[model samples]
Target: MVMGIQQVSLSADGHRAAVVSLRDGVPSIYLIKNPFERRLVSDTLAPTVWAQRRLRQVPRLAPALALASEALRQRNPFLRDASYTTPPAGPLLAASEPAGSNGTNGHGEAPDSTRYGTLRVDFRNYVFSSAFDEARPPRATPSYYSSDPFAPKDNVDENGRYRPRRYRLYFTPDLVYGAAGYDMLYGVQSVTQMMFSDMLGNHRIWAATNLLVDLRNSDYLIAYSYLPRRTDWTVAVYHVARLLPDYALRTLYRYRHYGLNLSASYPLNKFERFDFGLAYMGVNQTDIGNLARPPVTRTLFYPSITYTRDVSVPGLLAPIGGHRLALQLSGSPGNLLYGRQIRFVTLLADARTYTSFGRGLYSFAFRLAGGASFGPNPQLFYSAGVENWINRRFDSFPIEDLTDFVFATPVLPLRATDINTLKGPYFGLFNAEFRFPLVAALLPGPLPILPLYNLQGTAFLDAGAVWGSPSNRRLNLFRRDEHGRQVLDDLRVAGGLGLRTIILGFPFRFDFAWPFDGRRFLHRRFYFSVGLDF
Candidate 1:
């Protein structure tokens, strides 16, 4: 009954199957489900059949204007083959058209034929998708001229590394480029990070720099990674300027720093990875107004190890399911190795879990993180604002970074507060959020705007506390504040709703929040940020 099978595809669960067969010297498609039920999909079936299909039909590779424009083809020349006048057969992914929808849409069964719209920006997704191309399976692999020639018809570079014209176009490339995007924090930085890798992922390069927004301040960083086999090794060099604000002491400290780092990561199994890192950074303190403080400078050496368990799956906008846990221990032993007197050990734990309701349209996310340190200078915690907050405003609050501004934690989502306002040595934070998709479809025609797919809404709640003030060297939880209240009674709690969408190829979010202390709500707060949720 099934002797002339051309191709067969099985479902992951092995309960469903799609079979392609030759019937009367023509290809046909069929589907089989549980109970051994075979259903005919297309074999001259109904009013629209394969017999009426054109022999040679072209897909809508671009938008209507681009395909119709003579100027565009003259410029691109290669795109001249994209114009399709005759109607083609049904799309491979489409189901049977609705009762009246098939007659007007001659090319395919898509509603309004909106699936062929082009993108405005390249979103280089760094997670889930391997930064490098995957190992090809055993098959007749053919190399095509997919990239546009930088010079007339020359796609190969002097170094022989081929780069694809489209960043998302993955192939056996010599050098593929990626964008990690800019994170804009007002008065801090609008920094950009770029990433690149070879097709097989044997090599990777990273570069980061200030956008020259400030003529007086600048930062530069570069790194290279060898990611062949199971173990990955990376080396990095950096020059940066940092400002530290001590709200308790009512002073601002500035430092210029330089460093070199070496790191390695290896996967332990399918769900876990281990990491080791060593770095040396030096700092020079300068520019104090009024107070004639002596110029202070320090150098330190840091060695760290981390264990991570990540089983989460990628979603349209973020991770949708499973959980992840990371434990890290870092220490700066200037006294032992560099003989500079800076010494400390720090420990941290972070955990995240996500659950999807259905089809990635709705999901729940949860996170819990905490850390502590030992020795003369411990890890300073800056418990303020939300992560990647844009135009973040702060008041004169105390934040003492005794670790030479290194190993500082910027805890987030503590709303009804300004940045650098909260002061502490030890801290804990927890967040629960529900994300729901709004519009998850493509638009018709060529549009100037970045297609808004997977627009999402979020409802979240955050609870966090920072204790152990440096002045008293005592846990603030049991001690009374100047208000004659226990410090633990002032736990920070905030809840908000936000919208998320892609803009200029980056995930951007806008959030509005308010403080809720069980009794009443405080002043409303708003923030705009770029990046995904934890």
Candidate 2:
């Protein structure tokens, strides 16, 4: 009586349940009521029920237990308490057991914990923060890798297959031969050029000679030029013997000049530059097949200054956009600076504008140029045909027979008229052109064998006039035609179509032009030449 349970225990056989009670302050041991039945049921069903519950929780508990074990092993403070609440799960159990178990092999002793707790990490520091800085390991500049159309590629190896030589020489031949009406016309022209660096004490030197022979005339031009490294100055000496064609008078005039020239250029900015030059020349002239005029000889000193501003996008053959303006003043005096023969002052101004359309697929360009000469001497300015490095086309039959040909001059093209037919002391010219891509735009495929892929097409109109000096009455070439109209009233005008292409690093052009100023289309002219700017 008056019994209370103090402790409960199970027998070693697990088949009996026992309870210890304090009955009247005296400890007493007693078997639990129906101990055998309870033990039998517990032993048979308890293990299976516990196993089913644990299997259900294994998936959810595995990650948490693994994380806690990892944290304890790594000495992480956040999960240490949770990891200690239960023996570490799975394989980590042995390593995370009680310190006594970890310390010894059935013996009390401390083991090495330092080896398990240490952590090592490797870090890197940045060497550069911006792309513009030179790459520390040595690399090419940004411009060398740029694909911008306007970027310069002076040092870029475009093909990566060939390297250029330090010095080179080039030669070009421009020859023409034809026969018309019992006249066997023939011309042989050639230009031989040699260029080398450091030829004369760290200066670049270029030596060239041009030789031309025709049925009625022959000429030779020799020039030697020098340019110092990293400078804009040029020194040259040249000798030239040329034949001037007179279409009006149907005669050839011999002109000769040998000169030494020194010139320098200064760039004001990216778009503007100034040029100055001085020259001393010995000149001679002889009128051939005509006795009306005597041969004239003179020594001339020429000094010139020019200012140019170009804000144009350069193309393979010409400018595609923007404008350019040039102003020049040149004086040739007989008794000024070291001369005693001819005296005159000349002023010239030229301007050009280019407009693009259709996303640069086409362009319209216009140019205006004028020049005036003053003094008592008969300074000649011819207006008739275009400018060219080599005149491959034949001149009018009578004026320039198989034996005679025209030389290059300051004369600008009038397109519609004959060469050297209009001459005076003052002249002006205007030219307009519409240019578009030809083969490049149409085909646009790589053709290693065909160099004509760079062809460009153009339609152009040219008009110009020359007039006599206002002060000289006798030298006035502007007179009335048979219709009592001023000759100046009938300005020379012409229109034509042309094709341009590049060959051997130079631009070559072929033009078929017809004069519209009272001339039949049958008299149209064909010209083949080399030049970029019209």
TM-score of 1: 0.61
Writing each residue's lDDT as its tens digit, candidate 2 over 269-345 gives: 88998999998766666788675887665666779999999998777667889999999998766645552456677
Off by over 4 Å in 1: 1-217, 242-254, 288-294, 335-340, 397-404, 439-453, 472-490
Candidate 1: residue pairs that collide? 247-397, 247-398, 247-399, 248-398
Positional deviation of residue 71's Cα in model 1 after best superposition, in angstroms: 28
List of clashing residue pairs for candidate 2:
215-402, 215-403, 216-403, 216-404, 217-403, 334-339, 385-413
lDDT of 1 by residue, 35-93 (tens): 25646565542321222234334432334333346776434312332333443443321
Superposition error at 133 for model 2 (Å): 43
Q: What value of lDDT does candidate 1 attain over all alpha carbons?
A: 0.67
